[model samples]
Target: MDKKKTLLTLSAVAIGSVIYNYLKPVKSDVEVIQDFDLQKYLGKWYEIARFDFFWEKNLKNVTAEYSMNEDGSVKVKNEGVNITTEKTKTSIGKAKYAGNVNEGALKVSFFGPFYSGYNIVMIDSDYQDALIFGDNLDYIWILSRTKSINEDRKAHYLKYAKDCGYDLSKLKWTVQEG
Candidate 1:
């Protein structure tokens, strides 16, 4: 009888923990701006830094261009030169407001019906720099209007990302030319 009671109590505790975690308000794992103006954000952006990802391996001079689509979704064009192959590669994708248009959270699909989170966590008032993070916290990108950002600004963003529990060591500094 005691063994059965102990097993039941353990099961109850495990279930309780799962429920509590699910009910808790989400934090750092995924944070986005209150409102993101797609029009104001449209244009060219340089990839100053990013976490290592298979799609962009050994790439340099990375750039992303955002354009408005007639269907109300955002068109994304990413271009980069393969350092080893000396060839330019491009990937086109589409993005839509992940939850609501009022939030900076977006769902970007590179493949059909397969979307991933593209949350803009921080952006400068001038729209010159932005910190983009993924919902799973495995992806991160520091983007700028120019090919490079100032050391001060880079340091500030690094600190911000670290505070948010990102592994800064995983970042790959991008090289770009004007």
Candidate 2:
């Protein structure tokens, strides 16, 4: 009986550890922007570059559109073209501020009841460019109001991402269709 009890306790501990790790807020040296203006941020932004991942594999001409939902949540619309298949793909999601609304930290859900962190770490004064980070270091994106960004701005963001421990070699420049 004691042996069975010990096994059960160990199993519970292991499961709990997994859940905690997955649910934990992102711990990183990177900072999240404060005093974020969601109104100005609500619009279409093109993905200038990103870290390649399975979900966005073979995609190009990617763009993310943000709008307000009736229930005070931000609606997210992501669209891209599959270069290999020549098909357009879209994903719709919703985001709510994880912390204060003035902060740029948010929790977004594409799948029902499952949320992930979305942080806007940096933005230009005009709100024309932004640096976005996900729950972990593996997810990062450079976004611009237009389909392409200027060279100087691109270099600045690249440097910042590198300083924050991102792997530049994994960065993929998004193809923008005119």
Candidate 3:
């Protein structure tokens, strides 16, 4: 019985350590964009570049549509087509403007019962392009309304991302075609 208890304790400790490490906060160099104009920021945004993840890998023609909800939250609808499978997936979520509009931060909830932080780190004056950052600073995205971005524009955004302490080399440009 004593041996069993010791084994259980060690197992629990190991599990706890793994969880802590996974949830450990990441240092962010990206500055939250304050004073963002929601009206200008609204509308459809196409994903140009993003960090590759299991759910979104090999996805193309991805876009996010945003509109104001009745409760003053922003409705987020993300859609994409899987190049390999030729299947489409859409995820619906809601985002509430956190604090004042000047903060440029929003709380998004896709899990229905829980909310996550979504901050706008950089945006163009015309709202043509934007760089979005999430909690832990690991999830970053560069978005535009069109399928492609100009060379100069892409370079500019990359530089800004680097300035924000992002691992630019890890960025995966979303393949627009199969």
Off by over 4 Å in 1: 1-28
Our tally of clashes for model 3 stands at 1
Comparing candidate 1 with candidate 2, which one achieves the higher lDDT? 2
Model 1 lDDT per residue over 1-178, tens place: 6999999987887677567546643445756877687777899999999997888999999999999899999999999999989899999999998887877899898866666779998888788999998765578899999988988889998998999888888999998965
- By TM-score, the better pick of 1 and 2 is 2
True-vs-predicted CA distance for residue 8, candidate 2, Å:
22
Evaluate residue 147 in candidate 3 and report its C-alpha lDDT on the 0 to 100 scale.
79
Candidate 1: the clashing residue pairs are: none
Stretches > 4 Å off in candidate 3: 1-22
lDDT of each: 0.86, 0.88, 0.80
TM-score, prediction 3: 0.81
Identify the candidate with maximal lDDT: 2
Candidate 2 lDDT for residue 34: 88
- Top-TM-score structure, candidate number: 2
lDDT per residue, candidate 3, 67-172, as tens digits? 9888878999988999878899899999987667777788887764466668888777788888887665567788998878778878887887787778888898
lDDT of 2: 0.88
